[model samples]
Target: MKYKSQQIAYWFFALCILLFALQITYGFIMGFARIGWDGLHDIIPFNTARAVHTNLLVVWLLSGFMGAAYYIIPEEAQRELVSVKLAFVQFFSLALVGVIAIVGYHFNYWEGRKFLEIPRELDYLVVVNVLLFLGLILTTLFKGKRQTTTAMVLSMGLLFAALLYLPGMIWFDSQVMDSFFRWWVVHLWVEGVWELIMGGILAFLLIKLTGVDREVIEKWLYVIVGLTFLSGVLGTGHHYYYIGVNKIWLVVGGIFSALEPLAFLGMALFAVYMYRKGEKKHPNKLALFWTIGSAIVSFIGAGLLGFAHTLPQTNLYTHGTLVTAMHGHYAFWGAYAMIVLAIISYSVPNMTGRKRFDKTAGHMAFWLSNIGMLGMVVALGVAGVVQVYLERRLKMDFMVAQEETKIHFVVMLLCATLFTVGIVMYMYEFIRYGKPSDEALEPAA
Candidate 1:
């Protein structure tokens, strides 16, 4: 950290770890429920648990993105954050809103939308919080001595993400209309603007860790940005295939969504090529592993797996089944979750002035979580295939098919436990790094 204000990112990252742990816990609850352990069914049913699990994933990832912006924006712009105090305010308010939304789920106080389950009133608070966050980021970027492409891409992603949330908040009487707009938020964020955010962060990390020139990295960033918009925007059609939309989406969605993987493929090649091209002297090997790992894994999870069922022919059978769940788990974790972890792994040692890079536990945490998640994805994928064949193909009863899949949920639970253990280890590393301090600040090399 070359600026004291960047320390504000520490708290946000800390919150991210906390919420992520809670998210895993709820995942366990649901996994257990799937196997007929209804111990907490009365208090926290499957529906509520699923909502909390997914929503927490979003909240933690958002926190990590905010933290990345706070940490990266100032350094790239060559100035301190515009307002650290307001940054703290935005942090707490964002956490408060997330906590309230999650708690409300247990009591059935939420919208029925899948990922947009947070109530409309709380959605207003989220908008305000995000606006405050963006205000600080944009103000600092403009006020600083320089504005870099890395910073602009990241800021644009955040700005567009905030704007995209509005469509989901609108009140629509028709279910079809609501679903249409909902994809604007969900698909567009992950597959669209969020890729810009990832590319920006990846560029920044590569510049620091790889000793790669900014011009080289930012050039690749432009390719990624162009690829993302070209493919991802129309990729939303994949969701519209069976959602009562025009039959045209069949061709449109299949073609465009298949092309979506090219963007991710570009990202993967960009990261690996940059890594191979750089000096590679940075001792923060863990961060490098995560940074490189995120790119390659995202291509697999988001690109390949997503393509498997993205076409109308496959999705017609796999829609709303565990197949989607399988893709969702891996894609979100690979693309968004790993990038967040990469940023955190890089920033923590810098902020806290603790040089515990490449610890045994850190390596274990990465491998375990990723392997565990892969195992879980396979479990779910197999379960989904069985489910699709049984219910959709064989025309079996839904409950009977669900009963047949209980064994896979058991496998998922086992893998999730391994995943949770990795997360706990990572969180331990986070705590061991201790709090951020001014002593950590140094002149940028």
Candidate 2:
């Protein structure tokens, strides 16, 4: 039974690695569009690679989310997963559906929505909903105790994400309607529900790894929930600004999004404050690197950039440009990637029951990924600023101005290359010296 659970966890991890590798390759390939002109359309078109990139990000994120849920539910409940059978079934079902959807996407059969780009018909979409709902239901029943506020909030968010996704999946004749609902699922997932999940997981990890009492953690959880709902429920208005809507979204999005950064920044400060106040006997520094770094960078990248572009004044320059992509890349990294790294750090040691490492491989991997991402963020940001200067300040034609700053694209491509190399090193360390020794970290395990 133990072997089976561990095997399932690592198997999902292997999938994550594969997706990460693909994402890296496509990332580089897409960069070629800017730096060079190979005319590789139909093979690895910009649109095609972008779908791959975003979809892979979602899949790999879910892999980590599920794997962590499988592990933590047991520890909190004082029982194993209700049925490892159901667990594996849920995992594989997700994988199979992802494969089918992505294959269709690769063939250019998609409905042409950004996040909701899967080409599956309504029937297949329904199957996905059922699979997700069933998995959540089973996991919840198995969890037993309902008092773990943080975990429960996160799980409920996950469940609600599944539910919210259904309405957006309804087949529509007009592509615009499809596009609208697509944001419902896309923005609402990452911006709304995933933030709750992030709070839950971050709280749990800090409590366990930082040796803080559950009481202290739960207090923080309550605050987190308060801030998330206060900010996120209204903050989603940010997307409504440019989506061809007529609901006074500019005023609404601006006000709310201006407040949204407070939530992210709050989370970061809370994590750091708690870490400082709690125990300080740090283990392998890599284990907590992303966990801690995520809080800070997410606040700055997701929160601050969101603030920068929230205004109608600024977004007119930044919209659909490299600045927006910079925000996406960093926000995803700071929020999702950092959390995923923390989960791996927390789970891999427990799964392998290892305590220490001989060399600095894990640490190196952490720095590489973190630094690479930071590099991408800064480079892209500079290019974006340059764009604003060229198009807005200079009052030049759009494409003409964009062409004048071709050097920025080249620099951006170089940044992506650096980012990819970092992910490689990080993945290498994860595959190699993941677990140190059984005797050292047994108590935590």
Candidate 3:
């Protein structure tokens, strides 16, 4: 049942890896700047690097999601893609738009909004790119023999994700209004539909790797989706507590945001329960590690740390501090980044017909990257606490407070280097697997 169109995903993944490496490079730039190494300040500057670093994160993750769709949709729908040629076209245009946007950031050609800084002019192009991608995917699903729940859920997530982008694209006169709607995009995506995407992908991986019944696994998906929408939508209010919005948001946002962790808790328990319940012991242990790790870590990172400051009382003090950074980094790593890597680990072997599934290098990549990221999170958390105490509580000057926290960034950089090594090891495994071939599509004996 393997189709040649599935090969298209490999290219998108290649692009993903490229952008991720660039992201880490820029992250290092920002890290060094924090520690007083401002060699690139005149040229790149912290603002520019910050925008590039964050934007690249979004784009690369999207690339991974799209690649996952391209791979999964064909199999789930039980057919070849409606148009592989158009899929390639969408792929190139995506890379083109991402490159243009990154280059523009260096020259100060972007909006100042965090996570949505690609500018209005470029926004149209992004809309078009996403539309083309959606068209291909939906068309394939429509024309296919049967559409499974996993396929539908993944498609729904992708579709809703595209619709949500429009809110951020609109220009608002009031800063309050702009920031309000901006959370609609940022909070809603990471906490809302993105969880749907994560759930669908997680469901697929569990079904394959654990031999769980589809009905049983997908039932958990229903619960996860319910919890996500119930909490995540209203949780948007937490951002509005100090943004000059309605006072009602204080009650609404606090109550619902606190409930958000339940969804992630469900996801973690679901993955572990499914893994332990299944009789099949799939040979891809590394993929299992990532799959299980994603679930557990997301609960801790996104669920626990997020709840740590989500209450109106704590958020007032930690709103724009590095504490937010602490939550953001770990949440994204656990929720989105690890899941994408999990799928890549699972799919790459099947596509390339290489089963280097148990390599020492692969194990190193997982442990090193996770350990390094944990260390980074701790460093950022420590710095954030100090910043909040000095600048917010003690009313010290911001510059002085930052100087007091320089040593933490030094720790962050050391851990970041370890993370870089792990990623390099991952890239090595990817390259060694080589490219997909027609021979890989042959039915197994």
Candidate 4:
């Protein structure tokens, strides 16, 4: 018998909850050190924090994506997964790899690339990506049953994201060439492949949540995918500005990336418009949060703040300041983290066939986490501005100014602590009371 969608989704979301909790823990350590908490540095340093944060995110997202695949593929293909046993093997195998990579990272055995740091198993990531693509595609294509729906289109992006890595990873030397292709794999997955997946999933979700016509949602999905390719590939230039690329790349990159947010903003407007037209209200306000929130936040981070720094002039100073962190805070949480959570809200209940969650708890967690993310993003941006003011414009030495702003770092820590508290409350609620009712949970537009 096929497993219920609720079962698959909820279990996966539970994993996300756990991952977020771990993320906060990692955040705390990094926040402490950033604020001059030297004592904690010895025990858990920058690399350790970066690895934990990035790895945990990958694991949680993979789990959620798998659950999503299992849930939707069957219905779309008009068949069960090709092999539940294979699914288990794939899951366990990937998890095992993740564990080893994380452990290696903790002990300083990494290849030293953000989002590309899975130890020496760069090939393993390739293997896993290919496995996932085949698993989903072959199963979907089995028995001549196919529905090139939004969900399927998104899966294709996932598959290609993996395939792209082959070329993206090829280089003369591992170090120099590795960093070059590393962003191809990393940035492509995040800003490119995953954007498609998130859009598809969110569309699948909105269709279920609000009674918006599937046709409308699918069309919107196509537009999103097109925008992603248009901007994401060339937009990689933004990072290259500092990585020794031509000046023209800087200009082209900023323009494309600036346009990236417009796509998201379109999504937000589209979803909200649909929600308004829908005749009824769904119980999953939180699911809508990520779907819509991702767009708005992307506009702010990728669009506004990105525009702020896109200029060669501004970037000269803001390249590595807290402003960058500010962008990171909102962009990832809003674009990536929120989508995952939104997936949880939409599919988890369906997987379990139960909707017994504490709405108050979920909403509480939602608001708190939102507050925390906002605080962090704003604080980081402000801190960045302060740094630029002192170091770049004033001709002050970086260290001397840093010593002066030690208190400001403390404030950032406090902001992060507050943020962590919010995330914890949200995670706690999800862990304690995010069970679905006695049916599939649906997404809202």
Candidate 5:
């Protein structure tokens, strides 16, 4: 069932790793700056580092998702990619755009928007790149012998994700109008269609690693999708509550935001139930760990913690504070980042024909990274709570409150170093796998 065309994914994954390392570097810069270590303030100020850090997170995760698509679509569609050369072209174009954008960030050549900062000129190129990506994936799926639900769901997610980007691209003079539509892109992506993407990927991994029936796994997927749309779309109202929008959003947003956790809960329950029910245990235990861990941690990070502050009552105080950062870091790590690493863990072995699944370093990478991230989350959560009390409730000066939280950033940095070490171990394994070969495409004995 393996296709030679899947080899192209390896390159995208390599790019993903490179960008991720750079993201961590910038994250460290911000972390240190918080702790009064501003050695690179003149050359690369905190604002520039923040932009690079966040944007790189988005780019690298997209790269990983694209790699997953390239690998999964061929196998699920039961055919080779429609155009490997064009795929490579798409890959290189993506990397080039990302490089230009990240480099431009350092020079202040970006829009000041939070997530959508790559400016309008580069936005056009992004649209084209995504269109090309969609065209290839959809064409291959349609032309293939059979289009399974997993393939269709994954494809639908990708297509919808591309369409959703349009809202962020539109220009608006009013700050109210801009912020309103911005949530359409930001809130909707993470809570809405992106969940579809996560569900599809999770379904695929569950089917493979757990040896579960596709019928059963995909049935859970249908429920997950239903929950996601039902809650996530309306949940965008939560952002509208304080943003000069109508008051109706307060009620609407609170209700739906409360309901949002059900979608992630459904995902978590589905993964766990399938794992316990399955008879065949695949040897790729590390992938299983990540797959299962993604499901569980997402519920905790995205579901519970998001519900913690998303209510209008709570969000009023926590908005624009480090509390938001606490939620964001863990949610992204659990929902998107871990899943990407899971797919990489699963696919890399198959592509390279090397089964180093049981390495102690692999286990250490999983545990150390998870532990480190949890520690960081705790540190941020503690800092955020103190900030809320000092700055928001007590009306203390923001700078003074930030100074009070300096010690927490030191704790965050210590944990971040551990996180970086785990990632380095992961990169080591990826490099050790070397390149994919034609022999990998041949049937196993």
Candidate 6:
């Protein structure tokens, strides 16, 4: 709220909520398909729904991260955004690309890669869109009076993420080579640079909300960056194990991917320790809950659950199974989704001049969404274990195993319903915050 340009973030966050709702709708579609309810199979098949669901999740999070940058960079850099107009242009273009790519999926216009489903032509549009975004952020920082560590780390993360997208766009005839580079985009972003983005945002929030010294918090950020590179870089081997790579990857991946959780562990400890060490006078208790919750839950989801099947021996049986789904849900939710919500919860009130802190609905949204996701993960984990036992161990037919697993989908649907309800309530609260205002720059009395 310090600068009028910061209000641009409101629109991006709005887009984020809209896409997130769409994502949950598609998730419900897939969940129902799993249980033999294929009413929409002809119109929107499972593959289509899955693509929409996962892609929407990624888009929303990216939108949220962009919104976070727009809001944080102005304050951290001690100046207004360089060009608010360009930021809007970037935002709309990004949304347009997402909409086009998502709509195209129904018509089978995609690359067929797991996470890199957007067509190559649309990929170029995405690249242009991100370049515009990074240009606005980085230009503003350099022109400003100061460039804090928080701003630099965040800007660097955004830059690297943009650069990393190129590897996926490369044309490769060999499936193994294609898969190898695909992980450079997918695995490196989540396990690598995205952590830097998350850490930067977390540090900014802690300094503001927890009243911690900047020096103390930024020190932790350095440790996190170091740990992320140390493990996450080599951890790319985990995907190479069965992808026609050399046998050396088996050992490299097993040892390093196992160590990947340490970075997450460091994040959890950093948040908790800072929360305990700092003066907690911030009025936004709900934001505090989200900030703290994201840290702890990420440790469990990304750290512990990821470690569950990280080893070569365990992953051999569990690869491509529902086990991956279980980990994906919690890890993405805890590490990325929850942190996005946390920043939204913190920034919305300040930007919009609405003090809806600690509302019953807000707390309900937090707990319900988290608990529902946990239940869903448990159901998926159980289903994955049963599948590994029936198919991998016993050598049963795949169709038989899938039939047996249909019952678990019922449980998954129920949990998803709960999670959806929570999201609905969160959206409701977001709407209640109303529009941003120029008069809110002054501290609320």
The best candidate in terms of lDDT = 1
Scored by Cα lDDT, where does model 2 land? 0.71
lDDT tens readout by residue for model 5, 8-53: 8999899999999999999999999998999999989999999999
User: 1-445, model 3: which lDDT tens digit per residue?
Assistant: 2887888999888888889999999999999999999999999999999999999999999999999999999988878899999999999999999999999999999998999999888899999999999999999998998888888899999999999999998789999999999998999999999999999999999999999999999888999989999999999889999999889999999999999999999999999999999975899999999999999999999999999999999989999999999999999999999999999999899889999999999999999999999999999999999999999999999999999999999999999999999999998999999998777895633
Question: Could you give candidate 1's per-residue lDDT for residues 185-268 as a string of tens digits?
Answer: 999999999998998899999999999899989998998889899988988999999989899989988999999999999999
Clashing residue pairs, backbone N/CA/C < 3 A, model 2: none
- RMSD (Å) of each candidate, 1 decimal: 0.9, 3.0, 1.1, 3.5, 1.1, 1.2
| Steric clashes per prediction | 0, 0, 0, 16, 0, 0
Off by over 4 Å in 4: 1-6, 129-133, 141-146, 171-178, 433-445
TM-score of each predicted structure versus truth:
0.99, 0.90, 0.99, 0.89, 0.99, 0.99
Residue-level lDDT for 423 in candidate 2: 74
lDDT, candidate 1, equals 0.95
Error of 3 at 389 (Å): 0.7
194-214 per-residue lDDT for model 6 (tens digits): 988999899999999999999
**lDDT of candidates 1 onward, in order:** 0.95, 0.71, 0.93, 0.68, 0.92, 0.93
Against the correct fold, how does model 3 do in TM-score?
0.99
Colliding residue pairs in candidate 6: none
Q: Is candidate 2 or candidate 4 better by lDDT?
A: 2
Ten-residue stretch with the least lDDT total in model 3: 436-445
Q: List, residue by residue over 72-119, the lDDT tens digit for candidate 4.
A: 666556555666655556656666676677678778887666676665
